[model samples]
Target: METLYRKYRPKRFSEIVGQKHVKTLFINSIKNNNVSHAYIFAGPRGTGKTTIARILSKSLNCENRKDAEPCNVCNSCISIDKGNFMDVLEIDAASNRGIDEIRKIRETVGYHTAQGKYKVYIIDEAHMLTREAFNALLKTLEEPPSNVVFILATTNPEKIPQTIISRCQVIDFKNIPLKDIVDRLEFVCQKEKFNATKDALIEIAKRANGGLRDALTILEQVAKSSKNNIDINDVRNTLGLVSEELIDNLLKNIKEGNIINILKIIDEVYYSGRDFETFLFQTIEKILLLIEENNNTEFINLLKPLSDILKDIKYSEEKIILVKLGFLNLINFKENNNKTTNKVLENIKKESEKIEENIESEKTEVMEKDIPKFDEVLEDLKINGDLSLYIGLSFAKIQEGSDKIKLIFPYSKKLHFELIKDKKSFLEQYIKRKFGITKEIEVILSNSTEDETLKKLSFLFGKNYKIEGD
Candidate 1:
């Protein structure tokens, strides 16, 4: 059976949706009698480039057409719509992309139209044309016979040479919007007398990702599977799409650090016949959105380890990891039921909580520490290092100090201490070398006391060291 999308593919320029700019240009060109000999239509697949090309050919040859619009009732229009138009030659450049093909086309270009006013050559996937083929066609494209019109279509315009592109009027087609796809699908459902919910149509449109052909294909699949009233759930099941609720549940489990629940959800999704690669992609997309929202950086950080798992495009490997590690913990509910999984999950959750607690406790301890004032420490160091180089190390303090000199470090106590310990002796020697005198250096760790450091830093490095508080 012909799918709804194919069955209802636009037959005329007016029927093509969401490409007003291209349509307007073509219509105006025909009206103004300024039509180019060749045109290059490029964009994503199923964006109606080929359809528009055929329609334009019909309009050019139609017995009756308004401006550039094809009169669908005319023999020329009907033949073109049915792909039987003699003067409208459609070539699949992917299969016929060689110098020989170009020679054949060049030979045909010299001949007048057999049955139409202008002979039209439509080369789909024009980017596939070899360099020789493109070069051979360049002269004809630039100065084709008055009776010949060339329409070149490609998904990737970047592959086509600038020389070829310069000879043709380029029209870029954009992906059809989701709302437009849904509206069209709904219209198709009405025409076919099939009950379809808005939600179902929207789901199909989203899965189609702005491709009208794919959306219609999915819609046709669902229509065949469903007897009446296509619901969102029906669309999900028919398309094997993981449910948003399920995705939400998985995200919640990951956010709560419930590894067991996460595993269980993975198992459930797998058992429900969802592709693991799809799941991984969906998970990655969801995580990216969460990261954008700034609501779950910690969860994002935790999932960073799974980057390798997401890197593989093969489904089998993804399925293995998702089924074994992600879902295995959730599936053992029958033995210990939810109890065992919950216990393990809870344990992991507690460990994460404990780690967070430890971090907080450390922070509090640092805050309570009796660290030296920033001005005093800055005076002791005397701005020895280039301030610009060390400016990013904003939060510095002293771990240990004396009246003669002070030890300087970063706010992150460990890094600060480590850096001081590593560079202390070298820095001291370097300073002494620069000053031509021995200098006593004290090492101090910088905790979260950034304001004090900034005040003293401004004194040593001038107003340029004025630090902004977060």
Candidate 2:
């Protein structure tokens, strides 16, 4: 069965939804008898480069054409529409991009048209042509036969040599607007007799990313999948899209400085089989919208770093880990608007070092204290057959300061803290045995300790990152 995009493709300039500028130029040129022998159409894929090329061929060869519009009823128009026109040759440059093919085109360029007034050659993916192939076709393009027209279409115009580009009329295609794509989808639904909600169509359009053909194709898939009526939920399920509700919850968490919930949500989204890159992009999109409404500089500050990380996520072998790190970095960003979160930390570290230097230079008195040690606890656990507790506390650090003892763990050992924090008496008993005091005990994450831990994690996981939380 033909796809909706292929079946409903624009047959004339009037039917094209966008690119009014390109249409106007072609119409004026045809009306003025100023049609060029060679033309180049450059744009992103699914934006109607090849379609426009075919339309131009039909209009030029139509028995009846008005204002550069092809008469659909004419024999030339029908043949071109069906892709069976003898004088209209459609070549896939990706498949035939060698010097031999260009030579064959050169050989055939002098021959008169078999059926139409002017023979048209439409080369798709024109950027795929080899340098040698382009060199071979250069002479023909410089001074071609009057009875032939060449239409070169490509998504990446930068790949084409400047010399080849200089001899052709270049037209750039723009991405269709979201509203335009939605309207087109609605039109397709009415023609196909499919029931679709407005929001459902809008969601499809958003997923299409300003491609009309993609929107129509998604509409067809959703129509078939629904087997009754299409709704927003149907589109979400088909695309595995994270809901706006979920994104809002994420925003709320970030605003409230809830790092644990943010990390948990990332894990849930990753485990649910959502596309991580798409999730990051949609997350960035949602953040931008929130920044606009609330005028929050924090979100604005976090946006660029997250976007930069999102680009790097595509190359990651372990996407889930990178996603977790990316979110953590955002959560860890400080409230200071003057500097990025990382820079603030660097300044704080430098200040601390300066303070230490001053203390050393002044010969300040230092207090001595017995630090409650973890090695003794590990030995105790090993002696008592408590391997689970020993293993859990292996990565934890015990620091003793004036009037208090704190057990600090790296963020990566969150499960370990959960296990041992509940056994407060067990940890305190060891503290008393080592220090002979009942000082208050606190368990938490150490920023300085985590800095070192994250360095090791970077070595193990391929990226360095930090999150702020206890």
Q: Which candidate achieves the best TM-score against the true structure?
A: 2
- Model 1 lDDT at residue 337: 45
Can you give the TM-score per candidate against the true fold?
A: 0.67, 0.70
Clashes of each: 16, 0
Report the lDDT tens digits of candidate 1 across residue range 35-55. Answer: 789999999988888888888
lDDT of 2 by residue, 312-402 (tens): 7878889888878877776666434335657867866875676566445323211121343445555767787468777666656667677
TM-score of candidate 2 relative to the true fold:
0.70
Clashing pairs in 2: none
Worst 10 residues of 1 by lDDT: 389-398
